[model samples]
Every structure is written in structure tokens, then in C-alpha cells.
Target: MSIDAPYATLDPDRVLDAVTACGLWPDGRLLALNSYENRVWQVGLEETSPVIAKFYRPHRWSDAAILEEHAFAQELAEAEIPVVAPLPFGGRTLLHHDGFRYALTPRRGGRAPSLESTEQLEWLGRLIARIHSIGARQPFEHRGRLDRATLIAKPMQAVLSSTLLPSSLHAAYRAAAERVDRAVADRFEAVGPIRQLRLHGDCHPGNVLWTDAGPHFVDLDDARMGPAVQDLWMLANDEKAMSALLDGYQQMRDFDFGELALMPALRAMRQLHYAGWIAERWHDPAFPAAFPFAGEARWWEQHIADLHELSEELT
Candidate 1:
């Protein structure tokens, strides 16, 4: 059958059936959660509390890679970190049904963490530090890295290959992107060799939920090996905020100050990767509906201009 939507294969009935297969009796109520990369649902149970069921995007990750992420989250939980880990079902964390891979976790409900609060930022910083401590303990055997090849090269290739990019904007985009790529490489070179460790990979404010106890990290879908600053930079907005976060971070672990110099390069890489991600996923019906701007020639023009500006900033 042809796929019309990203979750075309993930019907509500299939999700409930998957939960039932895990020995959890579903109450026939399924609430689809906010997610673009994967299909997540809050499945109501008959006797127990509702559980969050996440069906991984097909072909996005290998079985071993997803299992590695589960192992990392389990490690953090074992250390008493406030991270939502996958609940093992039938002696395994990863399960397969109807050609989809998924994992079940107890529902965690909380509002977004207040990034504006110094106290809250500090608390989060400490928690992230503790997570980094465990992340540094070992390397992922199956997972990938956050470096030039993955961040810049592969993404650039994807954008060039995708039909989403307007032909009129191709020359400008290629010129700007190549310049940005070079600048990124140069910035990384100037920073010299920095330490890389397993990180939360995507530590934006949305991934964190705050409550009375503290903040708990939820998605490990992007977890991989990368510079520690990769996790820290996304949390802070300005110098003052970064200082506040580092204050708490230092209390728990020593951070390499040199990594600060690499932030611009990382930002440029993220910009490129994000565009490529949208272009690559444009075939999924959700992408067009959610990111309609990407289809416009003016948007590509502006995107190319932004790339040029990033290259200038890097220079």
C-alpha cells in the first residue's frame, strides 16, 4: 500500500492493539501526542494508569541504535536521574508489531520548564551535568555522532537531492551552503580538539518538563555522541543565562570552557541540518502541511540569504 501520511501505517486501532499485546488492557481511548518525527499516543488502560506509547519512524533508526538509546536512558534512571526511561515489556524494551517498532513508558505530565528562572535553570543544569556524567561513562556502539559528516555534509547532500528546493535558488543555495560549510570546518579547527561524549543530543526547552520535584528529561530519540556544549548551548539564551547555567554545572562537573568557541559552528551546522531534514521528509504528507513555507520560492530565497549571512558571521 502507498503511504499518504507519515503515520498512515499507524492507525489508532493498531496502537491500541500494540498496547494490548504488552498485556495492558486498553480502554479504547487514544490521544495522539505532539510529535513530528514519531507517532506518540497516550493509551488509556483498563486497570492501570495511562501509558505513553511511542512508535518509531520507520527506517529512521536501526534496532540496535534504538536499543542503545533505551540502554542509555535506563542507565540514567538507575543513577536516580529524573529522566523518563522506557518500560521493559516481555523482557525487552524494543517491541515490534505491524511492521512498526515502539516502546511504552508511564505517562509523565508536566508543563514546560521555566528557562527564564535562574533557580530553575540551575536545577536543570545540575540534572544535565549528572546525565553527562553517566553519558561520559561509555560510548554507543550502534549510535552515530554529531560531527561534520552527519551534520554538514550529509545534510547538504540531502537538500541538493530533494525536489523541495527550487531550481531557481539552487546556485545561490549551493554557494552559500558551501561557504557556510567551510566556515564551520574552520571554526572547529580553531577550537582545536575538544572532548566529545554521549549527550542528550536534543536538549531544547520543549524536551524538559518541570514539576515540584524538579525537571525531567523526556525524549532520547536524538541521543548520540557529541560535544558536551551541544547539550548546554541550546539551554541558554544569552551570556547571563549561560553563566547561571554554568555556575550550577561547575558545582557538579567541570566543563571545558574551550567548547564555547565552537558554538557558532554548531549553530551553522544545525541550520543546514534543519533545512535538509525538512527537504528529506517533504515526501511525508505531514511535512508539507506543517512546513508549507518550504515549498515557496521566496522561502528558499530567504533561506539562501540567511545561509550567506551565517557564512559572513562565521568569517
Candidate 2:
């Protein structure tokens, strides 16, 4: 199988078969979920609630790392936190079917939480704090970290190698990236020592599902070690929203205000990382289909402009 087209052979049959192997009979209804790094599906079952089956991206994470994520989610769920944890089949959460590693989770349904809602923001903040409390108990043995090198340098490299980035803009892109890199490093150094714990590394409104029961946290795929603010910033769009979030967070856990300074750096890093990810994954057909704008040279120009703006904002 080609590394670029990792999902080439993952047809509907394979998806259903993987689910059936988990001792669950599929009702032939398969719906693809909105995921790129990993393939996810909502598989209806025989007279039972549907299950969310996740097929991990090829070579992205090791068995140990994936298990750690599963264990963390299970821990959160066991603590009465609303986390969508893997449903262990025959005492194993991670299962294999024809070279594809997959796991079954109960299909959870909810609309995107309104980050604009102060009540929801505070509520989500408290839940995030609880997640961090559990996350602090121990560090991940095999998972990744949310740092400059891991998030910035590597993604920048990927962006550099992408053919999608026009050669004409190469020099400008590199210069902007370098400036952003230095600024991120300076910000990290300025922040001094940080208290990093396992975090929901990609904490945004989209990852949170809002229902009457409040919120349900899904997709811990990007879970990593980082400061508490990494989980808070994406959910709070403004200063007032951040204050509300912090108010709720402080009710459950003490938040270091110093980490707020890292927000600009984080935002810049995210921007770079997103571009890098799209570049690296452009080999996959789904990326091109989903991000048609990226194929245009104009988009790269805009991306370069944004990077420069981020660099200036940080500096």
C-alpha cells in the first residue's frame, strides 16, 4: 500500500468487517465522520445503539501510544467525566483487522457547543479542569508533547517540502517561518518554568459536543503534554469569554495566568502546524478535495502573509 494513499484499500467492506470482528453485527449502514488524520465512521448495529469506529492513521502512533490515549479516556469516563472512551472488545480496546487498527466507541451525538455562550464556556472550562486534574496524575510514556520543536519546527519542515507551496514564495515562507520560530522560542523562554500536564491538545469548540446534559468531550487523538491554557484558549474567543472560562476553571483548579502570555505563540504555532499538516497530507486525495484553496498559489501567498502577521504580533 502506498504511504500517501494509506486509505486506498480501506473500502466499505473492510470497515464493516472490522466492526463485525469486534463481535458487533453491522446493519450495513456506514456513515463517514468528519476526520482526516484518522478514518472514523458511524456504524449502525443489529438492534443495538450505533458505534463510532475509528481507524488510526498509518504509522502516526504506536500501539502503546494509542493505548495510553484509550486508557486516559477510560479513566476520565470512569471518573464520571463525559468522555467518549473506547469500548473494549474481549477485554481489548485496540483491535486489528487486515492490517488496519481500529477501536469501537459508543456513538455520541451533540451539536457544536457555543463558545459565545458564557454559561457554556464556564461549564466547558470546569470539565476541562477536571480532565487536567486526572491528566496530572501521571505523564504519558509514549505520547507526544506540545512544544516548539514538535509543533513548530517539524511542521515548518513539512511545509517547506510541500510542492503545493510555490517555489516563488519559498524564500518568503522560510523567512516568515524563521521569524515565527524565534518569536515562539522567545515567548516560551520568557514564560520561564511551566507546569505541563497531559492535555486535550486540540481543545476547540468543535471537539466539544453540547447537549442538555451539558458537554461531552470527544476525539482525544491529539492528546499530549502541555500547559493548561492550551486546552482553554481555543474555546474562549475573547477576553470576556476567557475571564468566564478562567472563573469556572479556578473553581476546580488553580490556573497560572502567566500561561496567557503563551497564547500568541500557541496561535502562531497552530497556524504553522495546520499549513504543515495540509502540506504533508496533500498526497492523500482527501486533503486536496477538502482544501482545494491550498492547491492555488494565491493561498500560499495568503498563508505567507498570515505567518508574517503572526510573527509581528508575537514579537
Candidate 3:
């Protein structure tokens, strides 16, 4: 018979066992957090502070790539940047248990940052500028780069080959996806050679946490080398908000305003990649339940229309 499921193997007992192996006593408390790419839990300790355990998805990343992610977090912490870095246990950052590679980090609690406040937006801008400054200092050897091939081509191929797209919509999706792909390529070419640096990769609002002290970044799992704009554009909801962010960014470092032109193309690529990501992970039990919209025909129709709209803007 087939196995139960992918994450079903990661039972509470296994989660606790993973923590106990690290020389910590669990208090029988485990809360599954909001993560789909990986299994993350907040385990309460007997006497010590609680910690968040992130179990890597099987075969998702190699040891070297995971180490590079840890190294980047450690580097940011050393620079006095407020980032949730993985705690070193027994002089090691990554530990393997029951065929799962995991890392432990101290628990950090905070609400989402207030994007509406100019002060808050500027604060984040300054923090991101510092991150980019350090990111430009070095490069990742093992991790992948965020480019057209990884974001567009691979995702397009995956969607076309998979049964995720209904037969009726396949032609429309293919045509729109190809148009968006070409538009993205042309936009990148028009922008010319932009600086590529080690980035937090996914810098949306959910990834940032706000406290009385300030904002601190969490979850560098998606960390990779990409343009500075990739990190900045997602946070901005409008031109005024973007200007406010740039106002602060320019204070700490030189802002490349030309990157603004690539925003439309970047947004289109992310939209295309998201569908492919869901389709690729559809076999996972969590995907269908979590993303119910992906199962419907209307959603795919809207997606095609959105793609065409994005393509129009890119042209």
C-alpha cells in the first residue's frame, strides 16, 4: 500500500523527539505554525525558553545550501541586524533526526509591521538598505538565483505538463504565459545589468515582525541572490508608499530608481510562479486543503485574464 502522507510522518511525537535529541526537555506542548513549504513548530521547553523548530522538506535543499542560509542569518545577527538566526546547538546549526534535517531558533513574537505609517515604512526601508549593503558584500555558491529561468520558464513548463490547468484553458494559459515570459525578458533587458546581491528573497509583510524596539526579519529559508528591487517592490502598495520607502532607503544608501520600471514584470513572474508552486506541491495533502481555490475552473480563468493584463502592462 501507499504511505499515509508526506507530513503525516511528522507526528507530534517525532517533533518532540527531535527537540529532546538536542538536549532539551519538552513540556508536551507543540503548536504547528503557519508554514506550508516546511514543517515548523513552537515547542515549549520544560524550564528553558520555547524555541521554533523548522523541519526542512525532504530533499528540498542540500546540506550546503541550508548551511549557507544559516551562515547568512548568522552574518546578519553579527552585524546587529534584528533577524531570527538559528541557534547553534552542540556547535552545529543543522541537525538531522529521523531522516529529517532541522534547525532550532529562539521564539520571537510580534505583529505585522504597519505598512500604512510612513515612519514604519521608512524604518523598514532603512533596515532593508542595511541588509542589501551587507548582501552585496558576498555571494552564495550553493543557493539558486532568482531569475527568469527559475521563476518563469520552469514554472511555465511545470504548469503546461501538469493536469492543474484544465484542458479548455491550456491554450489560453500557454499563450498568456508565453507572452508574459517574453515581456519579462524584454523588461529585464531594458533594465540592463542590475546589481545582484544575497537577499532575504521573500520580503513580503508577513516575513517582517514589529515590536516596540523595531522591526526584525524572520524566515530566511527563501534567501537567494536577486536584485535589490525584488525585496523592495512587494512591500509597497502604492506610489506614495514606495516614495516614502525610497526616501528612507536613499538616506542610508544610494537607491537605484531605474529598478522601478521592472516592477510590473516582477509582479507578473511571481503570479505565474505561484500557480506552478501550488501545482508542483499538489500531491502534498496540505496543498489541496489550504489552497481550495486552485481546484476550481473559475480561478484558472481569472488567472489567465490576469496574466494577459500583466502582459499588456509589460509591453
Candidate 4:
């Protein structure tokens, strides 16, 4: 953490003071939460329950984009969807202390959602559908949509720019990546236009918290305009689970069956994006320590091979 340039200035005293800046008294309990793109902490209060403070990554989002995320969360919460929205401090949700932009929200606890359970998948599907319903009501003026360029091409560029890929493997990497890129583009064109809507952009299991009562959404950091299927595909691991989820989803809202075929391309884009994200953020001390595999030459070999395999499937 000390080696990370982004968090170098953010110490324990500063974190607590950021809370105090919001007119909250800190009990001096600060625990680092599991987040890499941005820094998050569980800050204990002197009186009431603890609050989750999320310090936004520097330069990643503008003020309007961040506020748009807050507004979307509030919209979902207002619609009776169990989403963890930011709490206003002095009627402002976004705050700044020193240089970091941050927000405060009530801490909600739950375990990872059970994707294997049919009932759980259905419940999650319904909640996601409801979220999409609210998401579809309007458009995001600031946050950008999830698309092929951002997810695929941009990431592959990051990998090429970085020294992570050995010199010998550069040609192979580029060939595999370009092949995947063209195939991904073809799939998107074939799918024609998709119903783009505001979505929980990164809707994987890790982002969802499940309790006995039901699941609640946390972390709107990745919230953006995207296909509704972007929120649905990551929740299921197999055909059966996806079927259950779609069954529950169709009960509340009509879904485009065409988007189902777009999964492979989306998955391929995500694969490229993941590698690219690690490459782009490798300068951050946290990324290298966490993704040691990216440091290895063989990983690049495997990644290129995987890209080739994905290209085969896509073509």
C-alpha cells in the first residue's frame, strides 16, 4: 500500500479526518475493504453503526460522472430496489478531502450470492430486472456506455504499451488480439443494434451481497450505460443457471433473446479488458502485488493462446 502512488497520501489519520469532514465522529476503527480500482474503508462511528467510505480513484471519473452514479443508486433505492446508495452529508453526497473524491454510505453486510441455487438465481434475476427497469427510465449524460472499443481494443492497447509482454511474444499477442477484435466487431455488427440501458456495469458475483432477507447491491462505481444483458450474463455460470435467471427476468420484463448470442463476444471483450486493466494499472503498487501472474512471461503466452482460442470460437 505504501508503494502505491495513488494511495501514498492517504493514511489512517487522513481517512478518519475525511470522515470528520463530513461531520461524523470516528471511533478510530478503520478497516480496508476489498477494492482495487478505488480505496474503500469501513469507518466506525463514535455513536451509531459504521459507515462505508469510498475514496474514488483519482482522474478516473469526473464530478458529474460520479454524481450520476450516486443519482442512479438513489433512483434504484427509491424504486424499492435494495441498492446501497450514498448518504448525503450537508445535502451533498460527493465530497473531497485533500485531493481524493469520496462518498459515505451505510455499511450493509451479506455473504456472496449462491449462483448454484435455482431459487437464488431467480431472485437475483428479478432484482436485476427491476434495476434495469429503473435504469431504462433515463440515460446517463456523463458516464459512458460499455462498448467493444472500451472493453476490447483499449485493453489490448494497454497490454501492448506495457513491458508485461515479452518482446518475442509481441507479434503473436497482436495477431491473436487483432483476430479477436475483428471477430468481436463482426458479432456486434451481426447483432445489429442492442437495447442499451443503464446497468450495473460490472454485475459479477463479487459485487452482489446476499442475506437471508435477499440480495442488496453495492458499489455503483462501475455503473454505466450498457446492454441489459451485460448485467445478466455475469450472474450465471452455466446454461441451467442462466435459464433460471432468464425465467425470473421474463416474468417482470421482456428480454431480447438476441442478446444471448452476444455473450461469447462480450466474454471475449471482458477477457481482453481484464488483462488490459491490469496492464494499465500496473503502475499502481497494488496491481502488481495482486496480479503477480501478469508479471510472468508464461501468463502472456497463455493469454495469447486463450485469445486465439476465443477468436476461433468467435469466427
State the lDDT of candidate 3 residue by residue for 236-310, as single tens digits.
Answer: 999988988888888888978888998998899999999988888787888889999998989999999999999
Error of 4 at 31 (Å): 0.6
Q: What does candidate 4's lDDT look like per residue over 73-162, in tens digits?
A: 999999999999999988999998988889999999999999999999999889999999999999999999888778887898899999
- RMSD values, in order shown: 1.2, 0.8, 1.5, 1.5
Q: Which stretches of candidate 2 lie over 4 Å from their true place?
A: none
- lDDT (Cα, 0-100) at 207 in candidate 4: 86
Misplaced by over 4 Å in model 4 are: 1-4
lDDT of 2 by residue, 82-150 (tens): 999999988999999999998999998999988788888889889999999999999998997998888
Model 1 accuracy (lDDT, Cα): 0.89
Q: Positional deviation of 216 in candidate 4, in angstroms?
A: 0.5
* Shift of residue 207 alpha carbon in model 4, Å: 1.0
Ranking by lDDT: 2, 4, 3, 1
| TM-score between candidate 1 and the true structure | 0.97
**Model 2: how far residue 99 lies from native, Å:** 0.6
Tens digit of lDDT per residue, candidate 1, span 1-315?
234465786889899999999988999988999888888999999988999999988878999999999999999999999999999986899998888889999999888887788998898889889999999998988889998898888888888998989877788888988999899899888889887788999999999998887889999999989888898888899988888889898889999999998888888889989999988888888889899999898888888888888888888
Query: What's the CA error at residue 288 for candidate 3, in Å?
Result: 0.3
